[model samples]
Target chain A: MSRIPNAFAKGTAFIGFVTGGDPSPAQSEAYILSMIKAGADLIEIGIPFSDPIAEGPVIQEANLRALAAGTTVDTLFALVRSLRRTTDVPLVFLSYLNPVLHYGYERFFATCQEAGIDGIIIPDLPFDEKDELQAIAAAHDVDLISLIAPTSANRIANIARDATGFIYLVSSLGVTGVRSEITTDLESIVRVIRSATDVPVAVGFGIHSPEQAHAVAKLADGVIVGSAIVKQIAADPAGASNKLYEYVREMKAALGA
Target chain B: MMADKKRGRFGDFGGQYIPETLMNELLDLEVSYNHYRQDAAFNAELKELLDNYAGRPSLLYYAARMTADLGGAKVYLKREDLNHTGSHKINNVLGQTLLAKKRGKTRVIAETGAGQHGVAAATAAALLGMECEVFMGKEDTERQVLNVYRMELLGARVNAVTSGTQTLKDAVNEAMREWVSRVDDTHYVLGSVMGPHPFPTMVRDFQAVISAEAREQLLEREGTLPAAVIACVGGGSNAIGMFYNFIGDKNVRLVGCEAAGRGINTSQHAATIAKGELGVFHGMKSYFCQDEYGQIAPVYSLSAGLDYPGIGPEHAYLHQTGRAEYYPVTDDEAVAGFEYLAQTEGIIAAIESAHAIAYAQKLVPTLSAKQCVVICLSGRGDKDVAAIARYRGRNVHE
Candidate 1:
């Protein structure tokens, strides 16, 4: 079945996200392996899109860099295949719907299965629009991860109930970026999600520091970091492995795992 | 209009493909819009504003000189250029701003391309006493500098977006980001019929006044329906408005002219229908000019208004069902139409609208003189004088 469940079977999961083929496909594979080696429970590889509407400037720049380096869907799938050869860490893809749609739903998920991808996180495909790919994703044993945002007040229970893989709880309002402080009441949101389903809830968006990761891990089953880690890669694409390993290790440790 | 096969869907297109952070707000906006659209007082207030402030019942003037010059179909120009904000944008802006006010939203934000929609949104916000901010592409700000000053003078903060392509699509991306940050007290006054549902539907209903008036006016003047109705399609608000009332008329052809910057064969055109694939983007499933990987391609057009990568989802649905026909008009042809209309009718239409005029030059000649075609002059050309001069090798600067 899906490797996603085993990720949260332990204590709080530590999810590290990096844009696939950022800088280059080889460099991205190195960085992902680094995170996995540093005790990342799962890895989220962003299939770089031309216009990543859900991202802030940091990830947007990374996507552009990845695309500039000739990153494509096929290349990213190859990267996943390479990653699967080295490690069995549960892997997921964070992408917008367009690239996946362009790849053809059947072919994309089938390839994902072959490449050992566990789940997917599509920022644009909310619960209402999930019907387009939900069944196809399930047939491939791919967990179509659901997201619960700060504004998902009444929708929390409904979305959480039907959610698979895990529930991605957005730590704050707005696009994916680094925030100085996340003031949203996540504990309440997680409580509602917990009452609705047994699926793990991983808080993401704006979680940069270990303290923030530790704080989030208290209320949720996992802590997900993206733009902050992407910033590390953007700073030094070649030398980001050591930095990512340390950061992921620190964040994982902060999760009290 | 054909009924949506599903809620907020037009055939297989137009769904709320957005983040969960914006879902509740969109649902609330839909509820508020649904309520206000039926409320008598809301309609009367919007009507009063459209009539008195924005200038409704825009003239359907017979272009006799051009009609005789062309020696084909009779021509009528829907004078949306004569509106208060000098385009059809004010029609939707006024309606949305009023609805935002009713929803207790004190601030309004919008994305602009040619700055017509930005200026219109600013004017509506000023009239309704709401805070206004407009995001425009950095390139557009340079191209349409005069409209930039116009919006600033009208008390709106204009942000020159420096993101991807630095054009209309980037402006929209920036605006959506701003809205996601603050959806509580603020409302995103989407400028076109492109964005998520309620926007395409609401903007069309607001702009339907164009055809509602033109249909009756045409009947009163010509004693029968025109053979075709034409308008430029950027995000296709004006075209949809012009075609909405006449959609049931099987004989009346609904024509849309898309901007082909250099040519459709080149990579520089913004002809989404002519050279695009189906993809989900900017909060809707629509036809977008994209690469094989579904990455939105950077589109080009002389008219900043039409320099968008995608069309409104409804237009996609319309194109799919063979209900409307869209043709790509090159910038050179549009410029020719721009000059021709100025000289013949003493009316300088917006370059975006000139695309429709350029297409009419080809289409009208194919029809008999007994037939007629009405073109929606979506905006004034005053803002384009400097650009047109520059395009013609003159060193004119605004």
Candidate 2:
């Protein structure tokens, strides 16, 4: 009965992320469509926040650019509404909690429902504080996604049991950025999560390069690539759509391989 | 006397709304704080530092000349300005730095808006033999250069943050970002009673000594409770500290003066409780200066110390429950208060504290001669002299 489609139903899913208005809304919309065409199973749109504490410099700069270009939550919703008309890609909003709180939780979730947002990932909203927005997200059939970090330790099982949609397993111990190596004992964390829940888990954060994506996909249901995709837009916004599409295709192919 | 249901949360505010990566660190911090705060040895060492080093039991001076000049109520000034670093900031930095040492962290990091907290943190770190680094907004470092030099002189490495608005909020953002990676060896000495839990409560407990001393000093001198207790609110550290002991006293009015910048009607103000909407930012669910898009608005004030986008969560709770009254003090009113008190009492108060003095000037006219008022002079104005001179269309060499 839910409009939200499963992103991992076919194969090792490819989840691609882009800030809603990194260069401009139209360009971002074009980029998203291109990524979808290039085999992105799920699309995560970042709603730029003034203070994104969980993000590293790359994403932080992207957020600043998006905000500079006049990106608002309403405009992001409008973008989502437009995307829903042509594609059935599972779309999620990667945002901090303040914007949603300011938008009014009830209205925010209701708008997400109308605009066809499949899930919401607020990195700052830990499991203990999930109740603040969980009921509203559920009432609108929006998945309030949970994150299980390498540092979760005893809290991993607790977070896993209540997770909806897919769990976002953070690959490293720090903020979202590309890393040469992920030293966290992710296999142990994934084991703890698997023992507790039946929901699918997707590994994210510090994942860049198709080889890295291939390696992460081997461990989980899907691989989430964010900063890598966003960094392309940052490098050349004029040629971002084509470049990002190529990058997404490569990552998606690697996931399947 | 309503108790917080969770470890955090003052009413519907305050929580660990941080990234999952910081969860274990915060949990570890909470455990260490809970354990050490109750330990007698920890309390005794902290008490010794407060008394012998930072100059605790700060003077409760009777402002007789100002009281006579105002011609309404007897007035007293809780001289937190007389502390070693010339502000109530030493009260909190000393406590946090000591705790950091106990946690075996060798380095301490902090963010500063006005640079007073930075100076205090640097002072504490130097005394405790810990490495100190302070992140200050580039704009703030420019405005408060003397304090920047003072911090460097005290052996602190100051990083000027050039990100978003280049102000206090940005400084805090950079500090928190740096903390996420280096939390292993560094303890973030958050300057205010804001941020996530334990911080709001921890800072308040450390600052409560102000009101505790003021209450005793006032009772001894005046033989009765003052009609009101007043302090300026940025993130509401000194205000919360000055107000903590008096919360149960139903008749003692607890007043907080917020920076109105140019005016409350203008978009440039930092009067969060006066003009902001309830939302979550900087880890706490409190009133913040934000737009319809939920982007934090650029907040301004002549006093760098008072130029913050949000108040502490406890201030939000107190404002919501009507436990205290908050008023907006315009830039002009605060500057006038600064000059007025300087001329009348020969005391140059920090412009942040001048907001409280300005509020007292208004309230004093309405009270009887027998009534008394007490204001927390949260810091000295030496660091602000150049800024004040610039405001008056004058230039200073030193």
The candidate maximizing lDDT is 1
Every prediction: chain A TM-score: 0.98, 0.97
Instruction: Please write out the lDDT profile of model 2 over residues B283-346, one tens digit for every residue.
Output: 7889999988788889999988899999999999999999999999999999999998899999
For model 1, the superposed segments whose C-alpha errors exceed 4 Å read B1-5
Clashing pairs in 1: none
Model 2 alpha-carbon drift over 4 Å, by segment? A1-5, B1-5
Q: Model 2 misses residue B45 by how many Å?
A: 0.4
DockQ of each: 0.65, 0.60
**Candidate 1: residue A62 lDDT (0-100):** 92
Residue B395 of model 2, lDDT score: 85
Instruction: Please give the lDDT score at residue A227 for candidate 1.
Output: 92
State the weakest 10-residue window (summed lDDT) of model 2 chain A: A1-10
